[model samples]
Target: MKNNLDLTQFDFKKDLPDWQVDLITKTLSRNFVFKDFEAAFAFMTLCAAYAEKIDHHPDWSNSWNQVKVQLRTHSKNDITPLDIELAKAMDAFANQIQKPAEI
Candidate 1:
């Protein structure tokens, strides 16, 4: 499977919250909710920059306050380490933006 990871062995629950592996599409997907559209867009921008740096882009869409991201190595026809790495980066980025203001 070249760059592919055995899905059964990967611990997605521990790796990222609300992330799921879709067997049918061979992709790891997650949805992130933010306070508003600006926050959502900012998150997407951060992901975009990272994706460009790694040359591995995500299949994603942004609504007003939500961003849905799917990661897969299309060329490899499966989920690869890149998907996991990106998912982790995304989780970190989301956490930074969605944190509650400490009073």
Candidate 2:
């Protein structure tokens, strides 16, 4: 087993605290609503950059005015610090894009 992690800077408690139990990757799911596909895609583009910058990617899908994102660290096979960092990063990027908190 890995060392216990600190959750100070991450919002895991609010959305995924229990995710720590399962050693198989954890998914942080959020649903974003927009006025149209254009707006939805725009938010996704920004998220893409944020994910790349942090070296953590997400599993996402878009439909009409809604976008769904699920974050997980595949290689670790568990919820590690990287997933926490990505959650924080996504929160910031979503806020910057005027997306309301849903996670």
Candidate 3:
């Protein structure tokens, strides 16, 4: 995997405690579970708006009350700083809608 982001400064284990980064796939992933479908959709809607603003979208899907997310910088063909930033934003959004997402 290759990217321009400075990975050294990021302590992935602590920084994204709830996320999983797969080097084999070069993607950052997480599954977020909400109280209901509406809550799930609400989370997605918030993420969509933020993603649009940043011009970077996530590969995600919703099923009832769960949102499965995978983020990566496609152009770079690897997980980069953009993925990290987006994941952080997503976690924050999840917290705003409710208590927190279930891992």
Candidate 2: give the clashing pairs. none
What Cα-based lDDT does every candidate model obtain?
Answer: 0.88, 0.66, 0.88
Q: Write the per-residue lDDT of candidate 1 for residues 33-65, one digit (tens) a residue.
A: 999999999899999999999889999999999
Candidate 3 lDDT over 20-48, as tens digits, reads 88887888999999999999998999999
Please, what is the TM-score per model?
0.89, 0.67, 0.88
The RMSD (Cα, Å) of candidate 3 is: 4.6
Clash count, predicted structure 3: 0
* Alpha-carbon shift of residue 56 in model 1 (angstroms): 0.5
48: Cα error in model 1, Å? 0.6
Number of clashes recorded per candidate:
0, 0, 0
> Which runs in model 2 stand beyond 4 Å of their true positions?
1-11, 14-25, 99-103
Give the alpha carbon lDDT tens digit for every residue of 1-103 in model 2. 1344543444556765433333333455677777788778877888788788878888789999888777666785556666766666666665666765479
